[model samples]
Structure formats: C-alpha cells, structure tokens
Target: MSPDTRIHRARVLALSLGGLMALAVAVYMTLGAVGSWSFVLSYRGEKLLTILLVAWAVPVSTVLFHVISRNQILTPSIMGFDALFMLIQTLAVFLIGAATVTQWPPVLVFLGELTAMVAFSTLLFRWLFGRIAQSLELLLLVGIIFGVLFRSVAGLLQRLIDPGEFLVLQDRLFASFSGADPQVLAMSAALVAAASLWAIWRLPAIDAMILGRDGALAVGVPHRRMTAEVFLIVTLLVAAATALVGPITFFGLLVANLAYRLLPGAPLRLTLPLAGLLGALLLVGAQVVLERVLGFTGTVGMVIEFLGGLLFILLLIERAR
Candidate 1:
C-alpha cells in the first residue's frame, strides 16, 4: 500500500477504536441501574476514571518501550516493577501487619508505595543506564534475576505470616479497579500529562531509535542519551500505574501488539493513541462483561493475563522458527 493509503487506514481504525470506547462507556454506566443515581454515578465514575488512567499509562509505557527495544513481545513488567511492588506490600504486612496497613488512610498507603517504586526505579535506572544504556540485553537480564530474587524473598516472608494475614494479602495478588484513590488519581493524572508531553517532544529521536543505536547516531540522534531518556519515561509511567492498580503483568502486551497489527507500518504518533484507545475499550468492555454479564466470575486482570500469555507464547514460537 502507498504511504498515503496507510495513513488513511490508520486514521480510520483509530476512529473505530474511539467509537467502540464510547459504546463501552455507555454500557458501563447504564447497564446496571439500581437505586440512587447520585450514589451510582459517584461510585462507578471513580472506577471508570481508574480504568482510563491505566488504559493510557500501560499502553503508552509499553509502546514507547518498544521504540527503544525494537521488539513487541517484551513488556515494562519485565523490569521487575510488579515483583518489587508485591515485595513492598508483603514486607509491610509481614512487619507492620495487614490490619494496621488497612486501617491507615488509603491515600497515604498509595503515596508511600508509589514513592518507593519511583525512587528505586530512579536509582536503578540511573545506575544501569549510566554503564549499559546501549545494552538492552544486560538491563533485561538483570531485571529477570532481580524479579526472581524479589519474588523468592516475598514468598518466603509470606509463608511465615499467619493465614489470616495471607488472606488479606490475596486482595493484591491480582490487579483491581475498585478502591480507586482520589488523591492518587489526581496525582497520577498530572504525572501522565507531563510524561506525555515529554514523550511527544522526543518522538524524532524515538523514531530514529527503530534504526538501532548506530543508525540513530548516524542520523544525528544521540542514541545513548535518548535510550536513557526513554527508559526513564517507561519507568515513571509503569511505576505510577502499577502502584495505582496493583501489578498488571500482560495487559500492555495484549493492547500493544494489537495496536501494531491494527496499524501496520504506522508511526508511533498514530500507533500509541490507537493502543490507548484499544486499552480503554478492552478494559471497560471486559469490566462490563465481568460484572453485568458474567456476575463477577473472574477478575479482569487474570483474564487479560491468560490471553496475553497465549499471545506471548505464540510470538515466541514465531520468533524461534
């Protein structure tokens, strides 16, 4: 297809995504009308807002990450952020007790975890990117190793805790849109807005990155500097989103690859927005089915993980061949 044709097709698909997202929102709000309109609107509205935030944060992080890594299979979760966040939660319950943590204000708890993950990511990325900014291999390798270590440590601690405490901890074992914190949501909105602007400004360097480090440098892109900047952006967005909605292991993988297939050879400018719309639609639509249609038979996160894992394996086999 000609370049003009490709761009036109991308725009058409994007509009389709928006239309579906609007339909999903309509169903989510009105499908289960019951008692008070005020109560229903206030309650469901928060959940919708949380879903929208994750919709933006997760796909944007994953797509921008693809720009740097030049691969569609790997996700930001590979950085060990999910495991690290779980460890933080496990440690808090093990030492301080879940009941106490639960009693504390949700906003404070959210802020605390968000701060820890962001701070650790900053230090970790600064150290890693300093020496091996050009070596995506080493970065991913270390991340896998740390993920194992963190999960092992958290698991060991969990075993020692009481059964009641373990049950309490299970709420966080999967991602949930319920209990969306108002303060954290506002803060996350600001962070995502700022990150989006910075990412837009770096689009040229990001586009060049698909040419690989040497080619980017040849094209006047500061490959190493841009790589570091891109990773920092990924870390910020992923950490904030994970802290907000627990850990989402494979949702990004699902939405991102779908966006790639939907807009083949499209620019990041087109692909990223399309991915975000797909994310929002899938999330809201899935939530509707789970609650209204399926009667909450399963959590949204697990469903996404199962489907994404299948896709992950298919991609792996394709690459192996």
Candidate 2:
C-alpha cells in the first residue's frame, strides 16, 4: 500500500475510535439521570474524568513499554510494576494502619505512591539495563521473579495485618472507578498531560525504537538514551494511573495489542493516539454496560481483567505458534 493510503486509513480509524469514545461518554453522562442536570453532571463528571485519564495513561504507557522492551506481550504491569504498587500500599497499611492512611490527605498519598513507584522503576532499570546489560528475555525473566517476590511479600503482610486494616488495604488494591478521590484525579490529570507532551516530542525516537535496538541505532537513534527516556515516561504514566485507580494487571496489554492490530502499519504518532482512544472507549463502554445493563452487580475492573486475561492467554498461544 502507498504511504499516503496507509496514513489516510489510520486517520479514519482514529476518527472512528474517537467518535465512539465521545458517544460512550455522552451516554454515560446522560443516561438514567434522575436529579438536577447540574448536580448529575458535576457528580458524574469526576468519575468520567478519572476513566478518561486512566484510559489515556494505561494504553500510552503500555505501548511505550512494548516499544522499549520490543515485545508485544510485555507490559509494565507484567514486569512487577503493579505488584510493586500493591506491595507499597499493603506495606503502608501494615506499618501505619488503615485509619491513619485513610486520614492522610489524598494528594499526599498520591505523591508518596508516585515517588515510590518511580524510585523503584529507576533502581530496577538501572540494575537490569545499565549495570548488567541484560537481554530482553532475561529482563522479562527477572521481572517475573520480582513480581512473584513482591506478591509473596504482600500476601504475607496481608496475612498478618489486622482484618479491618486488611479490608481497607483490599479496597485500595482493587481498581475502582467510583472510589477515586477528586484531589488524586486532579493530580493524575496533570501528570498524564505532562507525560503526553513528552511523548509527543519523542514520536520520532519512538518510531525508530520500534525497529529494535540495533535497527534504531543504525537509523541514527540513540538507542540506550531513548530507551531510558521512554522508560522514565512510562514509569510516570503508569504510576499516576495506578495511584489513582489501583492496579490493573491486563487492561493495558489488551488495549495496546488491540491498537496494534487495528493500526497495523501506522507510525507511533497514529498508533499511540488510537490506542489511547480505544482504551477510553473500552473503559467507558464497559462502565456503561456494567452500570446500565448489569445493574452494577460487579466492578468494571473485574470485568476488564477477566476479558484481558483471556486475551493475554490467546496472545501467548499465538506467540508460541
């Protein structure tokens, strides 16, 4: 296909995804409303904002992570990022107790969580990528090991935690759209915006990096530096989203891979935006179905994880073939 034709197709796909996302948002905001328009909009607006921010952050982070790792199946969540976040939250509750943690300002908690996540990512990447010069396979293996270790520690702490505190910790661990604090949502929006700007500026480097390390280097891209920069941005985006909504293990993988399939030959500029839009569409659409059709019987996060897990296994089987 001609380059222009590919670009035109990508544009059409993006518009379609964006239009669907807008429709979902409208339906979510307006459907089944019983109160004053102003009150309903103000209340639903916060939840909608949280969903959009998370949708934008998760898929963008996942795509950048896949580019840096050069693996479609790899995600930050798979690399122990979400496990580490859960461990951090669990440890906080274990050490400080749930009451105090809950009493702490949401902004303070968000900053602390973000700081811990970024610090952890920096240390892990430095050791794996910088000091050892690990291959991608080895990096993934080590990440799996770390993920197991983090989960084990979290489990042990939860076992010892007071049951009430454990309940609080459990609540924080699951992804919840309705439970998002407005203050945390505001902070997350700022962080995601900044990360998006950084990503926009690095689109050329990202496209080059998609060609793999040696290929990117051959094409005059600073492979190591670009990888580090991309990892940093991914860490920030993941941290912000995870902090706001809790851990979402497979949602990013699902959205990123779907975006890849939907825009097969598109460049990073097109693919990234499409991925974000698709993420929003999936999330908001799922929430709409859960609330409107299912009568909120279960959380949207669980539904996403269920479907994403199936997709993850299918991708693995496909990869093996």
Which structure among the candidates has the greatest TM-score?
A: 1
Residue 116 C-alpha lDDT in model 1: 82
RMSD of 2: 1.5
TM per model? 0.96, 0.95
lDDT (C-alpha, whole model) for all candidates: 0.87, 0.89
241-295 per-residue lDDT for model 2 (tens digits): 9989898889999999998887786788888888888999999999999999999
Candidate 2 has its poorest 10 consecutive residues by lDDT at: 133-142
TM-score of 2: 0.95
- 54 Cα displacement, candidate 2 (Å): 0.7
Candidate 2 deviant stretches above 4 angstroms: 134-136
* Residue 26, model 2: Cα distance from true site in angstroms: 1.0
| Cα shift from native, residue 266, model 1 (Å) | 1.3
